[model samples]
Target: MDRFLSNTVSRIDAKGRVSVPAHFRAVVQKRGYSELYALRCLDLPAMDVGGLDLLDRYEQRIAQEDPFLQTADDMSFFCHGDGTFLKLDQDGRITMTDFIREHTGISAEVAFVGRGNFFQIWE
Candidate 1:
């Protein structure tokens, strides 16, 4: 069974780069997520979720609910930007862009929340 794990906090550097927590990186690697998919949140109340293959299941959910309209809106909001495929450095750090940093307001202290298939970064 897939489960979400939350036990780590990451620090965002001045350049918008953060080291993926060791435990979280292990989970991501175990799930075969070498490349991550990232985008800004469309739902104002929703959290800023990230990580690899996160959209697959979400897309399925949207398709099941409103295949035409809701899905289109989701695509328009989250899929419009160039989705970043993040690669972990030797030290397990993933760099965030200025745009993402500003959008999410992520500073020195950040939360790495595991949400089953993907994870979210919260400030």
Candidate 2:
């Protein structure tokens, strides 16, 4: 079973901050992760989030390809360039950046869904 599982909806405060679920936070902490790597999912108007394991796997996938390859370049830019690191506050809340909040169209409420090794936040 995946460490991060289940779906929950969280409220976004006026500052665009939302609480990461306690279970998810625990899972991340157990994995020795202090932050969440997030990116605007290209295929969906949502935020894709991952811990260290997912980021490591992503790096491994990219490393298998030649640096000059188009696919590699695209993955590097999409994963590294646009990736945003969010450090959870004492209450397990992260303040979303304005750019990402606008990009995902998330306003007052957001839906958090578990996706095996990762999770996603939807408007």
- Taking all chains together, the TM-score of candidate 1 against the true structure is 0.72
Best by lDDT: 2
Specify the poorest-scoring 10-residue window by lDDT in model 1.
Answer: 44-53
Q: Write the per-residue lDDT of candidate 2 for residues 8-100, one digit (tens) a residue.
A: 999988777999988888878877888889877878999888886767777899999999989999988887887788899998898878767
Q: lDDT of model 1 at residue 10? A: 72
TM-score of each: 0.72, 0.90
- Among the numbered candidates, top TM-score falls to 2
Q: What ranges in model 2 sit over 4 Å off? A: none
Worst 10 residues of 2 by lDDT: 50-59
Error of 2 at 13 (Å): 1.2
lDDT of 1 by residue, 8-43 (tens): 777777766888777777776677776677766555
TM-score of 2: 0.90
